[model samples]
Target chain A: MPEVLKIKNLHQTFEQGTVNENRVLRGIDLNLEAGDFVTIIGSNGAGKSTLLNSIAGTLPIQEGQIILKGTDITKLPVTKRAKNISRVFQDPKMGTAVRLTVEENLALAMKRGQHRRFRPGVKSQDRKFFKKQLAQLNLNLENRLETEIGLLSGGQRQAITLLMATLQRPDLILLDEHTAALDPQTSITVMQLTEKLISEQHLTAFMVTHNMEDAIRYGNRLIMLHQGRVEIDLAGEDKQNLTVPKLMELFQKHVGSGLEDDTILLA
Target chain B: MAIGVYLTFRILDLADMTAEGSFPLGGAVATMCIIKGINPILATIAAFIGGLIAGLVTGILNTKLRIPSLLAGIITMTGLYSITSRVMQNAANVSLLGKKTVFTIAQNWGLSRNNAVIAMGLIIALLVIMLLVVFFKTEIGLAMRATGDNPQMSAANGIKTQGMKILGYMISNGCIALSGGLLAQNNGFADLNSGVGTLVIGLASIIIAEVLIRNLSIGGRLLTLVVGAIIYRLILALVFQMNVEPSDAKLASALVLVVCLTLPNFHLPRNLKGGKQNARSTKD
Candidate 1:
């Protein structure tokens, strides 16, 4: 598969050139191929979200280039990057407008990158298409299209958000702990839905998760980050054969820290 | 009936100072036109236009200068006192006294002056409410509402949040100006210090309407606000009727607002499981 996303010598720092300046990322190099599912695992403030944000163009990178599908979008603005890359934020509510109806939110999402005018009417055909898409989630949201998103449960809204993010078939989908707000069962459901959407659409995806088991289980490749650098980059049969015990052993050997945290190890 | 009008005015959330100036300004303009041998209907139109201008100024100050909405309104209102006085030709007060007011014109057309004022107010309110309702249903309107609720989200969605903010202030101030114009005409004079403590009255009206209408639907909520404004005015009228000194009127208005601010804190029984009532109480 062709490389869909490439990050070359990426560097990012928070509060740069001040007494409180802290370097978050240092000389990070990474690449993602088409239809690749990669899970990122890191401890707190490990620059995982920052990396994703950099790629999504939410945060401006301090140094280095981001090449998406053979195009350099390093200095592009957030609105411009939105056309090629979509994001599901850690907070479920961040991704969608809570006050708006689900259908209205979806309509806005569909119109992303398209010039919108005061059309005064919504076509029946567009409604039918939206219904068909919502039906695929099997969350009974197809019937609740007119209901305000604020009334929906966090998990349901996240599902709807995920659906909306992928509606345009963006070149890359960034899942920044998208299921973190959900209950365990709902989280599992959303994760399954995400995996299905990624595989079926053949879309390149990067999912950041604190859960070690999910990181090892969900994706074809698992990348572990320590102190702003990639500590482990396992793939294919090696990634599949890697057990939780072996992963813990590798973390101790590589990062000089045991994977003992309940939040990280429990998953 | 008086309570209903007062409550409706409160719900409209206009801050009421515009009404103080605009109501009297409307009266001054209408009565002046009537004295000039102009048609009563046309005089009323002129009054409404005067109110619109007042609202426009307030909106511009708040939106363009990044001034706080309340401060911007207060400034506009203070400035309007002198402007209205000048418009009335340096007269501290303009009185219809014996001239044909819009009310008298309606009376000549076989309607009572009181009935005419009520009809005119309702007609203008209805037109405004309809336009707002339709606008809120449109894309731009949605963007505007979102800007009011969460400006950051609107900006992220590529909506011009600044423009929407300006538009909201303009619409709000415009309604207030119109109400003021109506009040002035009804009373037959524009008093220089008319808009004093207008904000409190508007807030009181808003609170009362929210208390009456429990639903969260945007249209329902907006209608409730109008109802609140009317109720707030009626309460003031009733207080005046109860032998309260005219000098203590501002004090009475302040007390009404204090009660309104406190009323939501009074515990009410929850009717539904996971009802908003419980949520609201907790928030308070």
Candidate 2:
């Protein structure tokens, strides 16, 4: 299997050389193979979002090289990287343009990396395809094609954001705690939808979550980040059979310290 | 004219003072062009291009140089006063008493001067509105709208947000300048103080349109701008009929806007159109 993404010697530091200097990511290296869905688990103040931001090119790369499909994208701007990488932010509102209609948002996503021309937006022929895609979500959003996204509920918005993220079938999908803002029921629905979309599209994805159950239940692989480093990594049959207690034992065994707070992880 | 302000203020979310400078700049440029024997049609275009340049300056100052948008517009507007004077050969007014304009050309086509001016304004406004409607529906136009709607989302979606903003400003100011040119020609001269209170008029037109037509489609919204302008003019005429002093007209327009904005929120007499009955029925 070929590697779809590679991060070499990644490092991120905030307020460098100052009294409040905080080193978030320290000499981390990660690689994701094709069709890999990796769930990252970490405690608060951990560099989960920082790593995702670094990958998405929102944060400047102070010291690292990010290669996506053999291309050096370390210096590419956020929008340029968006051609190959689509992101669903933790906040549902951050993922979409609230003022635009659903069809208009999808129209934007459809032309992700393509050079935008003076052609009519949401072409007549493209409407059928958009309608089909929206219908597949089973949210009855097909009829609300012209509705502004701001009018949608939070859960509905998150679901649409997920759909928009995958509209262009990006090389990598970054979900930065995408469902963290939703209610339990809505979160489960969105999670199930996330799983369905990933498997159906056979996509490579990086999902950062605070919920250990989610980190363990989904994804073929799980990574634990502790103090700006990869503390433990599990995959395959091991990840399949993993539970809360077993994962805590593994964390204790690997890090040589008892798990400090299981509640944060459990929740 | 109001559409330019509508673009920057309502759409782009930028309160640009560039219109104050560019409006008169258009008049200065067009009057000078006509004085120099240029064709009337081409002179109006020159005025539009002049406004485009003014808008571009403000856009660059705000985007490239990191000046705040409001200050950048003020800087450009302050500088334009001198530029407009220079364009008018340092004269306070550039009269077109013996000069031929688009209005004059229309008169030569066998229309009365009054009819010619009215026809020219109507035709040009209609044509510009139609073109804008088409332009806003295009992909580039969508991107521009998206840029204004949310810069962060736009950048994330691979749009060069700064460039879109600059382009939006250029289009906005260009239209404003064209209106300025028409105003100068129709009124028979370009006065140095012609741009005064222009921003207020533009804002009033936009507010009136939005109040009159709520939640309209994009095309309908654009059309409402023209209607709003007409309505605003009518209100001004009424104010004049009420024996209001000419100089106090700005104060009167501002008060009209205040009333229109607040009226929708006020609870009026219930028996009018059975407002109470509808409220009770809907509650059920």
Q: Could you say which candidate leads in TM-score?
A: 2
Cα-based TM-score, every candidate:
0.80, 0.92
Give me the runs in candidate 1 sitting further than 4 Å from their true place: A1-8, A57-61, A65-77, A121-124, A257-267, B1-109, B150-156, B184-192, B269-284
Docking class of 1: acceptable
- Total clashing residue pairs per candidate? 48, 0
Estimate, for each residue in A1-267, the C-alpha lDDT of model 1 and write its tens digit.
Answer: 899999999999999999988888987899999988999988877789989988877688789999999999999866677777877877766766665678777776665544446553234676798899999999998888788776788899899888878888888988999888889999999999999999989989999998888888898999987778898999999899988788888888997766556364455
> Which regions of candidate 2 deviate over 4 angstroms?
A252-261, B108-112, B267-284
TM-score of chain B of 1: 0.78
Would you list the clashing residue pairs of candidate 2? none
Report the C-alpha lDDT of model 2 over A1-267, residue by residue, as the tens digit: 899999999999999999999999997788899999999998887799999999999899999899999999999989899899998888877767766788888888787767888899889777888889889888999999898776788898899889888988999999999999999999999999999999999999999998988999999999998878898888899899999889898888887987777678878
**Local accuracy by lDDT, each model:** 0.71, 0.87
- Score candidate 2 by DockQ: 0.42
